[model samples]
Target: MNAPPDIATEAADHVRIVLVGTQHPGNIGSAARALKTMGLRRLVLVAPQKFPHADADAMAAGADDVLASALRVDTLAEAVADCRLVLGCTARSRRVQLRELRPRDAAAMAHAEAVAGGEVALVFGRERTGLDNAELQLCHAAVHIPANPDYSSLNLAAAVQVLSYELRLALLGAGGEMPVHAAALPAGAVPHAALEGFFAQLADTLEAIDFHKGRAPASAMRKLRRLFVRTGLDEKEIRLLRGILADAQRMARLARDAGRA
Candidate 1:
């Protein structure tokens, strides 16, 4: 009989590496190679400029299996819709107020989420400008790789390789046991899509109640998003919050009708 698979490899199977707006097919291929080398199998591509190109296949080399199974989606949200934990790998911090984690810390967090039976995603952005503020909003946290400040421009594949290597090390260090903090995490955390739905409802409710009062809602919404995401809400908590929002909307509508009367 074949030997059983190791705990680390099993957990890795639940993690997906997401690339957004990649401009080069060769980089995708090289990224695939890097993932395969680190024992990670799943790859998600979001709005790549070119795929199914000879350059990608050529660069993949012996990592054809990883390339062949790569999933292509139109948007980053769609790519990570079902994921319970999404970490964006960025070279530097942006305006978004997400918790920052080093590569090793990120790897450990991702590994813990995966081991707890949740889908995890490590998102990478475009080659030139990196992930935009809107894109960063979808992520629960940011992973920063500290490089020389004078020359911090890292290739997309190189960034992927660094995270992949750290993740592999994290998995190996697990020693076949769940991390202590993993047990404290809420079980059955809602996926990204569900949380997004809540945010949409929240915006609508705010509008109904005139919370913004002719001012731009962008700043308020950004702060609200940071507050809620930091709490790591579960499915039950999301449902409760949505229920409150629905009631608020109804009350606001009634108030408007009374004023008209």
Candidate 2:
């Protein structure tokens, strides 16, 4: 089970590029070109404002196949419904509390997930507004492109190209190895939705016990969510955590009943 994967083949089979709320047809086509250049063929378009236009085909250059085969969906959740790992690309100053990872790190992580026989997604938001806070929250973690501070407004296709390049580099590492920490990562890792559910239950358990004192419970919850994400909880770990939370909730209920009696 420790054999190195055929990086390109695995990436093509398990990794997907998700463009959410794309406003430009050219950008979509350019993103396809980027993915094709990096040997990644799967593309998913979510609620694009403009698509199937002449401009898109024209901009696709020689990579028209990627654009032609791209999957179109209505929402980001739909785009990544089957993916075990979803990494959203966002600017660094979004003020969203997420585990901020660089492009290289994110690429490596995505590649590792793909190698583990799990589907992975690299999500890019709109060209203008980028991913809103809500959309960002849906992702397992956020990738921050560390561009120059003076002018950080990266074009949609350009961002895609940059991340694609990083993914390719990560995949094309020496000796067919994808430079991953497979030993550290847990076995049978759960999907992003499971982690989200755990976070919700954790918050509920905390609230039941009056664990948060301040008026900003959401703030505390956000930090706790980031902490758990960084710790990399797998399916069994998540189940264990959920059991503890349930027990805490039951204990709290008993305490309340005793007080009433």
Candidate 3:
């Protein structure tokens, strides 16, 4: 007799494991195996150097179904565009200013978002370099695995396995209830794509209004991103913010026209 589907299993459906810029086909297969062992199935690959290879198949062992159904995308943005909650797995914090979460805490967040009907993604980076600053910027938070300081290096598959195990434990511990104090994404929270769109529009509006004031915009934009991402802006808030930007842009255009006259 099969076990009944529970909240954890259903929530797992909304969670995806994303691998970005993977260099090894074997790692992909191994990651798939790890995910399957923990009852996770969704896998998204972003710009893997080698995939659909014999070594990947061999490493996946009996988890061929996972490899077969894995999604391949050209960029990290595409992999997690629809996700409301995206957590990047990093060995260490980078220049990007993101809230850091331990694997267990990250798993709780993922479960909370999934339970709240939001898509969640746990992202891993390349084997050698890990996720770059630009890639890290796409993530809502960073998930750091605390290994021994003397030798903190972790294999790509191993990192995936760690996170997968944590997520599985979180799911099992929930016992069909949402994890307490897990900071669930609000039901109205916008998808990553929407937030990205708003950011682009905001940049354009800032330029229109000369917000940078003859200075470089990268630093300011980064700060702005950090501020907004931490707030977990929802659809209504995003719309409101974008509307304000539009007005600012219009006023800037009018000012420029009047000055010309």
Candidate 4:
């Protein structure tokens, strides 16, 4: 039996496949083709190394429509600016300490969100390195395909195919029923851009307060980013945090002035 009409419609409309810093144009085209096979239409490209090449068109085969409608942006944050549920597809080893789910589990979560009228993004990183720690922090969770342990390498397009196939199954209610964690979702989640703005202010505030008393502070900032992202702050919460940061910045400046006097 086919998927319910509503399920199929939500699957195509609410979910988007985002490729970040793609190195090859052909992979973009091939990934588009993969989504087409599973009735997924939305595709977003973030700062691809090469695009609009004839090779990409050739690789797309008959899925020209998917490529034609693909949205191109300068960064992964921009690509998924409005999506409420973002999942980063990563192949990093067990040492990486993010919430990891298999492709099917990830797809089921994404499917449930989409069905609940939330925008969802499935983010795939560069072909060579996958997502860096900073990029992974932007997503709510990490998706790891459970390939063979000894030879776990999978191509970019192939990874897309695996996730897309599982997503299709989830939407169709195939392979039994998928659980929906509706109660855990945010009540009024803000856009990705809002979180980014807060991060910028936070960095400035920390700098003014001399929070990172060291030669280099990149590592500290990375950990802080992960800490805040894990909270899944909504718009009101973000505003509250920013207000606090602004006050901290003002107090820091006052203290500096007092020391000068």
Backbone clash pairs for candidate 4 read none
- Sort by TM-score, top down from the best: 3, 1, 4, 2
lDDT of 2 at 244: 95
Residue 79, candidate 1: Cα error in Å is: 0.7
The number of clashing residue pairs in each candidate reads 0, 0, 0, 0
lDDT of 1 by residue, 1-261 (tens): 221458777899999999999999999999999999999999999999999889999999899999999999999999989999899999666578777777877787887788788999999999998899999999988889999998998999999999999888777774343445433433227899999999999999999999999999999999998888878888899999999999999999899999999
lDDT of 3: 0.87
Summing lDDT over every window of 10 consecutive residues in candidate 2, give the lowest-scoring window: 179-188
Instruction: Write model 3 residue lDDT over 1-261, tens digit each, in one string.
Output: 222458779988999999998999999999999999999999999999998899999999999999999999999999988999999999666478777777887888887778778999999999999999999988888899999999999999999999999888777774244444446433217899999999999999999988899999989998998889878898899999999999999999999999999
TM-score-wise, the better of 1 and 4 is 1
Candidate 2: clashing pairs of residues: none
Off by over 4 Å in 3: 1-5, 174-188
Model 1 ranges off by over 4 Å: 1-5, 174-188
Instruction: In angstroms, give how far residue 186 of model 3 lies from its true place.
Output: 7.5
The lDDT of each candidate is: 0.88, 0.80, 0.87, 0.83
How many Å off is the CA of 116 in candidate 3? 1.6
lDDT tens digits by residue: candidate 4, 78-197: 888888788889986453456677787787778777877878999999998888876886777788888998998899999999999998888887835654442243322666778778
Q: Global lDDT for candidate 4?
A: 0.83
